[model samples]
Target: MTAEIKKQKHVGRWVAVGIVGVIVLALLAAIGWYFVRVNPSVQQVETIETAFPEESLRPEAGEGDGQPVNVLLLGTDARGEGDSLLTDLGDRADTILVAHIPPDRESVQIMSIMRDSWVEIPGHGMAKVNSALAYGGVPLMVQVVEGIIDQRIDHVSIIDFAGFEGLTESMGGVTVNNDIAFSYHGYDYPQGEITIQGEEALIYVRARSPFSDGDYQRVHNQRAFLRGLMTQLMTRENLTNPNRMADILATISPHVATSDTFDLGTVASLGSQLAGIGNSNIQTFTMPTLGTGMEGSQSVVHVNWDGVEEIRAAFDEESMTTFEPPAER
Candidate 1:
């Protein structure tokens, strides 16, 4: 009986040690997750707000409640020695777009504003929309766009052309529906259904020399690329898989510069709502332009206000419904 009791005590001690070990390991794992995942996400949101101050213009929390939010997305090609970001003194706004996420978060409306189109720059006089940024950075760009559309913008996310590779590669390349057959940079892109790799998508939209519409067709191709990108990101398979998430995060991390107002928690919640939305629910259009002209040495395109106002009305129904001042020469 004494020997049996000793064996039982030894076994009990070992079992207690194993239980403590398991608990310690679990505690360590939770701490690791909090630091590696949750903390960085929170930091990302705070960093975004610090980057752009325009986020304050968003309707107050209760005012719009769950209404749609507007984001100004800039895809800049000004990547040189000192002009990598718009922070560079001479950088121009290459791509200007307004993305609207509705209250339900179920749908999104993306309106692309042509960079070269001429419009009134608030502090400065009339000039090409792209020139607004070169004049006064994000502030001037926001002022001009808001003045033209008569709507308050929520936030801004600026990404480089190089970032395109990350996005295309994240989804293992996106499939774009080409309207016509074309060749550029020694690569032939056929019409109908086609899959494009990271490098291919870059050259596909960057091809402006061969197209008849020139910049006009380039804008159209951009719209097509965005459509494909959104479709791929929101798919059911991509959202739930860890491998896809890692690729997406890797692709988005280095290339994206967003306004400080974006909350990661909000984005996490919004992602689920966005999954239900489709391309059909979203609207995409470009600002009207009158070819190109020379403002002394700069080649710029004049804005066609009539067409722009028509599209603006759809977003800001309260004011932009009609063009009161009308277009001028």
Candidate 2:
């Protein structure tokens, strides 16, 4: 081959390879954006104003604000119409948890409140705490929780059951230590470590009939399952793999709705702050309550007034690491 002809062929081959590389990079960028971009279903509320608003009691605002960040996590069974947003009306909150991330951001503490706990919902007479969601939506739920803990909630996330299943499956199922074996919906979950996904995971979190304590034991299981799930998700392999992370995010976003005050940037910032925390650093506790009793005709959990104060003090002082339950006290 002539030198000039060979040189021209070589130039053509290099141009073709460059075009292919650009195409591949563009495709990857598009996939990343699809997964990383915030979903519209995560509706932000302008302000999460509670019924009893005391400016003095609210946590300070600014970078390094020297106060623990509180997020109210609501797990609802409200299956809205297909593609419809979760509404406040006629829907009940099945799970209520307050996730506290201290200013140091070294750990996260989760306190689960029994849905059937009898409490005074602001503007409404004494009723089941979960009823607040049906009565006043996110605002009422926040108001009631704030009243109980005496802490300002910085953000709110409402997750449906579908999202829970999707998130668990996206992580290839989560393995939680099953302290007690139980059967639910014809599926037998033996004691010891168990890995569950999809419908089985839903059954695992929702089971309550087998235990004498009913919902109380179920809450404990939920916390164990959550800890296991977080441990799996925080692994370097999962976080660094864009495709895995995107699949997880896409599965979760549509099924979640956040307060208007919380945005994509806020979510990313919080994730960054909490990146160092591990499952061991995440402490989970059930809100202190006297055993279940009948209120009129319906069964409910009575709040232990003294124990409640101790729990509130721990949150107020940002000392949950050392905080003990009423039983321990």
Find the candidate with the highest lDDT and give its number.
2
Question: Model 2 clash pairs?
Answer: 44-259, 44-260, 45-259, 45-260
User: Candidate 1 on 83-147: residue-level lDDT in tens?
Assistant: 33544624455567887665556566666677777777766787878777777777667767777
Global local distance difference test of model 2: 0.76
TM-score, per-candidate, Cα-based: 0.76, 0.80
Cα TM-score of candidate 2? 0.80
What lDDT does the true structure give each of the candidates? 0.67, 0.76
Candidate 1 scores a C-alpha RMSD against the true structure in Å of: 8.1
Candidate 2 off by > 4 Å: 1-64, 88-91, 325-329
What is candidate 2's lDDT per residue for 212-238, written digit by digit as tens?
888988998888888888778766676
Candidate 1: give the clashing pairs: 48-259, 48-260, 49-260, 49-261, 66-103
| Candidate number achieving the greatest TM-score relative to the actual structure | 2
Off by over 4 Å in 1: 1-35, 38-62, 79-86, 293-298, 317-329
